[model samples]
Target chain A: MNEPPRLGDLVFTPEEVQKRVKEVGRCISGDYVGKKPVLVVILRGAVYFAVDLTRELSIPFDIDFMSLSPFRPGLQRVEIEMDVDIPLAGKDVLIIEDIIDTGLTVNFLVRTLEKRFPRGIRVCSFLSCPARRIAEVHVHYFCFEIPDVYVVGYGLDFQGYFRNLTGVYTLYDPTGRSTQILKAMGKGGKR
Target chain B: MGDFSIITISREVESLGDEIALRLAKKLAFEIIDREGWVALLREWNTELPVEPPLEEKEQEEWMVTVRTFLREKAEKRGFILLGRGGQRILEGLDSAFHILVVAPIEIRIQRIAEKYNQDRATASRILAEQDMQRERFLMRNFGIDWKNPLYYNLVLNTSFYHIEEAYTLIIEAMRRATNKVPSVPVKQRSLFEEKNFLKERVFFSHPSEEDFARILDFYGIRWLYEPRTFPLVWDEEGNVVEAFAPDFYLPDFDLFIELTTQKQKLTWKKNKKVRRLKELYPDVKIKIIYARDYEHIVRKFGGRK
Candidate 1:
């Protein structure tokens, strides 16, 4: 068995996350003032951020969840593990994302939503690394712009662990923390 | 391949037909002939053909015919589970052949493509659309058949609603039934009876649980109307219906209605009251509520929610 990965440096404290979430919420509330927008939160990664952001918003809105697949061709096609139950046609939809890395998956999601003919669609990401983006995406709302690094915690995971952690941390030594976790779990290697 | 000879599985992108076919083949211990396998066979049959992809339009047409002919010959000798490569068209009239088409909505396919590539949904969707168009054209050029024509298939499965396991079992049952038919008689002799045309104006379910309910009805060979009729339980002062209940599924074969609710019991109290009134008003109607706890058990046992 492979060792579990570890976190390195604290990138965003829980307080920082809470603060940024409020700011984004305020901005969204102002932008879609009278409109009852559907907040489509990308699952797993953005779930924590989405919940906090929803609370910060004073305006009445509906909440929905979507889980997206990692992109690949052939056997691994882009798939939505879960879809929002609410009808999206002609509705204002705000996509909440945890992090925008390559901007590939997010771009795909936006296009997918567009086919449903929503009145308008905007993106709000908790974290983004513009330097590493391969696909072009315009994020309307963002919290922290961090450097390209392995980040985990607060719903982000290194091999499905550390998602329970309260704060965001970069894994400078990928092998270090993973090894320790694996040792504790009585295992070792990739994940 | 026990007794059933040839199985042709057609599918749209991201429908998970390939996975279901693989599992079915394994269960039956049949020789699987997927796209790559067909390509390999094509190479062995004639060294002149291009082994690499991106074949010219003319080459692709030629390849389809050659592969179809090859599969026909192979099926004549023994059984095989053929995946794609227009097997449905080629094996159409074969007595022992079973043709299945698996499909899901475009949105679901886009999501699957995105996940597989770990790429953006836009790129994944574009590729799927392109691939579908290519497949459509390929079939039209080669066999003059629409890829989605339900008439060409013995079974059309919506994998979006049916889990792989449920799908596999359905195929097994269908194949078993197919095998029991007289050897010389065509499987198409079986009455379609609300099969192909059933999808016209079909409702797109908002939840996987509802989809699963539909899948079960389909697996049992039952005809169902999705939220077809609304039953009014309360009326407004102006003689207008104030409250009504639309059950998730109405089974025509059994004359039964099914309501699937994953909502908490307390949350559904009002809805339950309306259903009770609906029952009282229409005493002939039979309704069943699949509550959250029972629904979870079904999901746990069947593995469809995944």
Candidate 2:
């Protein structure tokens, strides 16, 4: 059997990731000082980032998890596998995502949440992949802006692995295209 | 034809068409673009032409083009009611526009004119005749169309038979039904994965599962053709007979054929063998076999029952 590719050079170290998350958390705290925001973590990927980011917040907040599937039978819309238990009406909502690419899911989520009559809705993703964005969405807070490459670790995964790692890294690409991209970004050389 | 966007109101003088248009606009929260509104739009475009187009054919055609362009743009932006201005002829084939013509008996129209204008019966009859003649001549000269033709309108309302409120309500209901019906023709260049245009045709599925699968595909806005082609796998010695395989669905957007097998695992081997043979025969044709388990998993994920 062919061996699976190993992890490439680290894109963000544990220390660097924590520092950026803290900065973003502090910014959110400053902006929403008087109000308690509902932090909605998109499941199976954003769990780790949501936990770390929420821990850094100094204000009072409620946390909820949502799981969504892209397709639904007999309906041309995204299906919500799991909904938030808390009442979202008249509450400030902040969607926490591991990554934002294509922006279609975020846009759909925003529109879905808007029907709940929330005071306002915003997005906060750990990584923003603007190169892969096809839908227009405003990211209120993001920790890092990454290129369009196969990224893993820190709640992001490749084939359901490498998500438990504390820091983000690009997966080793057999075709070398990801390596070329990382090199262009001044990373993933020898280490 | 598409969404209920534009409404064109053509009415005989004092036929309650103006009242219907005004009330319908208010009820539907639509903008009523009457002669005043049209003049304002013309002024906004910096055109100093009269409210009516010139008698010359070329100038009138130019005016018609300008008016049509403005009407199309306005209709695309928002729902509005267009009053008069040869709207029926100007937007003859617009799928998003609904054309209405209002009429009443000559005696009723004369009575209305006399009542509304405080004129005598003879004067009212003379005024109605002159106005009707002027309108007929205007339409005939400008558009080369008979203004009173019922064929030009999707609906014709006689105010003598219905009150103003009843007239507008009926119009609103008709507009809704017209908009909901599938368009007889394609209106614009459709993008991939859009709502399928085969809504008007009744598709007969061999199995209920196939129908369910088609519904799921439609939910995702994936355009598909059912059993569009059959590939001959075996031919007779004389080349007159053959065995063939037809995939359940052909997704034109992806250029892929999907064969759905909802049978038990043991029974699916026959289909698998046929798919294998098809791949060997036509190496370039892309095909996928969605097994029963895979379909169940998809349904389960979406919280749907079998």
Candidate 3:
């Protein structure tokens, strides 16, 4: 008989995030040197990460965004309820996102994009918190691995008001509320 | 609870518009004023009426003649929550009744059709489209107006996303607001014939009851031409003409004025002002009546006021 292990503490400060983005950018540049990769960023939440991630890659790229509002708060669903379409058929596609927490929203995006039949599909997320990651999701590249604490900021919003923040920061408020915020923000979490 | 009694649901479809309607006969209150029943009634009305029924009973005859006298009598005495037949227009003069239009978005309606008939979404969409066409045709033929226009209805509800129970709650609320119940007109049944005829004139007739006003001229054998008050006038306190029910119905033959009253409620000061304004705008036509209960009978039956 064995007891399940408790989540241990982990941290990746602001500087560490920039260094990871540079590395991710290098890998993206090397991978798609001559090809045009269409980057589809989901709106309201992923604006910041998509911008930073695209900045790192030095290849010819076209950018588009899809906005959805299914799991706004107090709900858990495995579908992106609403989205504006992006041209994806026969073209190589890259879905750049902010974070992958519960992975439901991301999974829906993957399934939906698969239906459209892109030439190739890949996901690049800025942060990955695997302890909370749900099954059936694959993020091809990610920035840093950190212990699961609900974090916000860096274009990620808390109630859509805080996305203006330039960099990521942890909640100094109730950890439970932070978790609630995470579950809420987890709507568009990684994939 | 009773269907025949023109049941006003206290809850929504989720709470059981269908369930209540289906259960009504067993519950034995009245006939279910549901879709099939409503369609049957409409079909029967369509069977009796000419392609387009007249506004006044006089304007309609032969096939166009409806349960005219009965509509007058039952309107004052009946208790049914008249579903979708333009029945509201027929019973417009009555003050104690509740006239409501139950509406849902295309998605919810599509979903319900799919679930009810156990058909595919596309099939359901097609069916809904057909029903909508049938309804539009019926309204055009019967009321001489567009059914989707909210002005003709006492209440316009968005039932698409609402829980059936929430929808029912709204209907119940309408019953209350209607207690102040702006003395609404009864609903009439719509048919397809009026639709084709209206198209000949190049007018979009959406309300079933409104068809009465439009076909008034043709039915009466009167050479007068009338147009629906497609655009309503926004008015002031006094009954002075200041706005528009604009581009009034043009009746070049009779040199008479005719106004369309979708329902039978008294012309409010605001509405009166608009009507007066319209009258002033077109002085060529001299008549100044709602034709709420006139001229139509003559067109249908070639007779006097019903």
Candidate 4:
């Protein structure tokens, strides 16, 4: 009999995650030496990641937020909804995100942010789950590449639970395709 | 035409405004847009409602994060009567919105609340006072509007004098009537320009072509009513009643001011005597007398366009 596999591999422990973010911070600070930078963080899910990323930086920068959702009441197919508008004007902006799962949210945000005529913009994400990616996004810096799974813990939630966990984990579903993929493949290397 | 998004109600409480809104929802087949609707139905901020805004910096930082979350999910095409949030100001000039204000006398409001809450006059009064405080704060802090003012309302119907059926009829009647009317400024409005913020131009234009004054104001933007609408009749304050000339056109911003003109020679001795007497009492009174020649020059220069 084969054992079930974990969705989120041990890409980095909490300490490693912190170090990776610091490296991204150093890269950003060097690039934006004399520019007026406004870090526009996509709200809700990005709050935790944004906090960690900003803390890594030593440079003085302002922060703003915008909220967008693909799901709305009357629409069946996914579409963008803009909320909490900000005036980006001429400042160089950087978007810090938690995860780019489908890459839909990040792509939509970048395209829309470009229309504001910011001096420049780049994206940073904590996780990029490429195997599950449907939409393409250009990420400047990211910590880990996660597998396609129902991820939870480390501020990620499954139905608003498990957001306070110290490390990321995946929940199992009996009928999940990712679980089935693991089963078909047999005992693989560590998650 | 598109799905109705908002129904802004400027109601004086205890007038069955809530019930009427419910009934209107049934009549028009719409839902009541409360705070719950703002959270559950709409997105712009996070789902968690803030108990209080921050007094300090770091706490404020987190508050803003939640605020953006709330805005992200705002209702696109909601159908409901939004009561007392000063919702109209939020929807300045949206074409798809219907705004209605309900009002009533103090006594009737007091009576209604007293009956509904099953409380005496004193408790009802306290409840009303608390509600008014909340509304006042909400309007001032959230919407930046004076809720007590009737100017905030589209159609102010007094519920103290009128019953719910009458009020509802008015709500429906107003809705019916409103549909026929223009959405934003009422298709046919009283103000010619509907000029909310009419910036004053540098040049003073006080002459007409018939008067032969032809100076054109280079700075002033063109308007349909820019032509000299009235002739200046210079009045000298000879009579005990002050004598002064009125400006050719009424400028709503100023008081007792006149447009200047080079037609000093047009003032006859009789007119000059009255002007002198008027100037003596009200030395600062603005009397504009335009030269007949300036109007003629404008017509000649502009190829008789005016």
Candidate 5:
């Protein structure tokens, strides 16, 4: 039988996550006081982060969700599984993302929303991994800057599991070994 | 109907082709042909959804052929004024065709473009230069012919000095001189000239984030496509669907598939599994996963401004 995957060192405790979220929320509220900016969330993953972030925001803002898929090659279009229902014209928009990877997805989202003639656009993310970025995406609000390690729990998941974990933890091999140890083992075998 | 019926206008950027074409079509009582209408018709035949301006070279070439076929069929009927798209070169064999090249000095063209487009001089200049290059390259690539070659034209008018009315009068007078005579067809010369190739790379975005990505790529002159196809990773017990991954941007020039993970830790493992499978299955394919911090850095550098 296959062994269960082990959770590595705890990176962010539940108390730490709450502290960061409240701090980000306070910052956003202070900045957007009377603007009534719309919060547009990127769905399927950011849903949990969006809810937590929204609860912290004292400012009045509407929320919308959008999902996008890349277009097949040879085609010049992208597929929108779902689009924001709110009209964005002349409105300040705050895009709520769970994480920001290469910045392609958010960059793409920002450009599309610009066409709608929004007065302003900003991005807010729960966490970020800076090393793998290829496209530039402006993020106005964020909680933590984590390393480029696979994390799960508190809405971040590994293999569609572990979102229910209360704290953010690094994922490791099922054999209870850190990835670095496994790498060393493989290198030793070659030697 | 006289044998001479077609009047083709070959013009440089901001030389007033639209104004001249409209007036010429009105005077001759001929239908004003728009290539866009033909494209719409072609779209109806090809796909249910309205097609956008083609981004692929092959697709653009196909559209050009459609344009030629549409114009050729239209010219078979009565007198018509064909504007741009090397109509003069394409229909040069027709004895009834009178080709005119309208040209202005670069300064005059720049000024005209600035005023007409309500753009600043610098922007207008950039636009005019790009348009000029595209036209020149298009003609050279399609017909292996030079746009400025006087041999391809019957009359070359300097639009800088002449008013639109004066230009129109000159064309009418020239038409009268060749009214009853058939201009002998010049032997078709295939030009060996090769124009510089330009990429027709473009991507349409459904989300604002994707749109931002495209702008950055355009600013950097890097070509990208969004989620073009699905790469199947894992199969179910019955070989049914399990996990499939569609990367956000495929940078053809770099031969890399970039998947941006803005998702919290939840699905990264699944995504990694799929990416690993993809690499194992297609060993030559390169894939990269960009996390949130790097993307924020990029956004900080290039986003929010334009």
Candidate 6:
């Protein structure tokens, strides 16, 4: 039997992640001091980041969750599996995402939410991957900017595994390309 | 229309050609293979190839073959309306397929574009020019023929003078006439205008900033409706008087309305106040204001400006 893909190297330690999340949370609180904002957490991957970041918010805010069907070949449209129960009209909306890569999904989300007539809408992601962006979506707030690399852990997964892991890690690359890239970024080499 | 199962429509931008094709499709109960349909077909056939038609000559040749084969197979099963993508040339000699060329006077096309995009005549003219050049070049490069040459098409339609319903009825009548004709005889090509009379003019845009914004949206394949809807902000005591706000663009895919303001922050207060009032009145309507600085950032990020 083939062995499962191994966790390669630590990209962000638990402490680093928590610290950045807290800082981002503080910034959000400061910026939205007087207004009540809606933190729309993208389901599955972003749940961990949303929970951690929301806990650090000093101001009052409402939380909602949404999930989108994964892109499949031959499927002409992306379907919204779970929609937020809150009425978004006349409310400030801050979409919480684990990663903004390719910008397609977030762009779709923003467009979808825009139809709801939110007072204002913005994106706040845990990680921003500009290198992989195919759709141009503005990330108003982000904790960290990451390079184009396959990363897992901290709610990110590798074939449904590694969500339980506390820190972000590089997925074990047998070809060593990812390991080399991560190491150069001063991340990997921990295992 | 003698046992014809395929109708290929080639149209200039803002010619209402697509609208005519759609109406014909519904009336005839035929599948319409337009850009979106073609993309879907391409995706299903070859998952690796990009959905947009390839630009390289050799690659385009291969792409054309794939498309032609797909169309042939599809026609075998049921009738369909093939819109543009050099369909006229792709199935030129096919017995069951009839080709159409839809055109309009440059001024009329530009006027239509201006109204559709909520832009001024000059801006509309510029857009029309850009789109015409692109279409001309695409046909020239792919099919190696002047698409405007009426000889390639069995019927040439001038939508400038005809309404969409009228055009649709004309096509259906033509098809009925074709059905009565001898199957072995070649249908004579009809030219609505002489070659010299085929004057190509451009479309409209309201502002240079808006034009750039539209280009970015087009580049990303985002569908947008220009000034599609207006919301009432104020009403008189008798409910007869009114104040209203029309957003600049509505993106159907995103369900968002975007209003681009290139004015300075202080100058934008009026627009902002209108937007706030609009939100209060139409709580279900989602709108966003793209201020000058924000617009510049977006343009910079997307390299929208030339």
Best by lDDT: 2
Comparing candidate 2 with candidate 6, which one achieves the higher lDDT?
Answer: 2
| lDDT score for candidate 3 against the true structure | 0.52
Q: Weakest 10 consecutive residues, lDDT, candidate 2 chain B? A: B191-200
- Docking quality of model 1: it rates as incorrect
What does candidate 3 score on TM?
A: 0.33
Docking class of 2: incorrect
Ranking by DockQ, best first?
Answer: 2, 5, 6, 1, 4, 3
lDDT of each: 0.69, 0.75, 0.52, 0.53, 0.66, 0.75
Q: For residues A156-180, write the lDDT of model 5, one tens digit per residue.
A: 6654667777677766534333345
Report the first chain's TM-score for all candidates: 0.86, 0.92, 0.76, 0.77, 0.83, 0.96
Give the alpha carbon lDDT tens digit for every residue of A31-109 in model 1. 9989999999987778888888888998999999998654222222356879999999999999998888646567768
Give each prediction's DockQ, rounded to 2 decimals.
Answer: 0.01, 0.08, 0.00, 0.01, 0.03, 0.02
DockQ of model 4, rounded to 2 decimals: 0.01
Error of 4 at A186 (Å): 14
The digit string of per-residue lDDT tens for model 4 on B133-191 reads: 45544543333234555544556777667777777777666665666455555422112
What is the C-alpha lDDT profile of model 1 across B1-306, one tens digit per residue?
A: 235678989898779988998898787767888878878877887778654322223444555556556667777676788887778765566666788999998778878888888867656755675566556545533443456878888789998789999999888887777675644755342122223234424568878888765554443234455665566566544334467687887554345677888898779997788788877866667777777755653433223111
lDDT of 3 by residue, B2-82 (tens): 112344332223223455334433443344455465556556755654333553323543223344444434434544444
lDDT by residue for model 2 (A1-191), tens: 85755898678888889999999999999999999999999987899999989889999999999988645544654578899999999999999998886465676688679879899999999999886543458999999998866578898776566889999897776667677887888876654
How do all models score by TM-score?
0.37, 0.46, 0.33, 0.34, 0.41, 0.45
Per-residue C-alpha lDDT of model 2 across residues B120-186, encoded as one tens digit per residue: 7766765675576556545544454446768668899999899988998788778778885645773
Candidate 1: residue A1 Cα off by (Å): 3.1
Candidate 3, residues A90-115, lDDT tens digits: the string is 88888887777545456657757866
TM-score of the A chain in candidate 5: the value is 0.83
Error of 6 at B199 (Å): 26
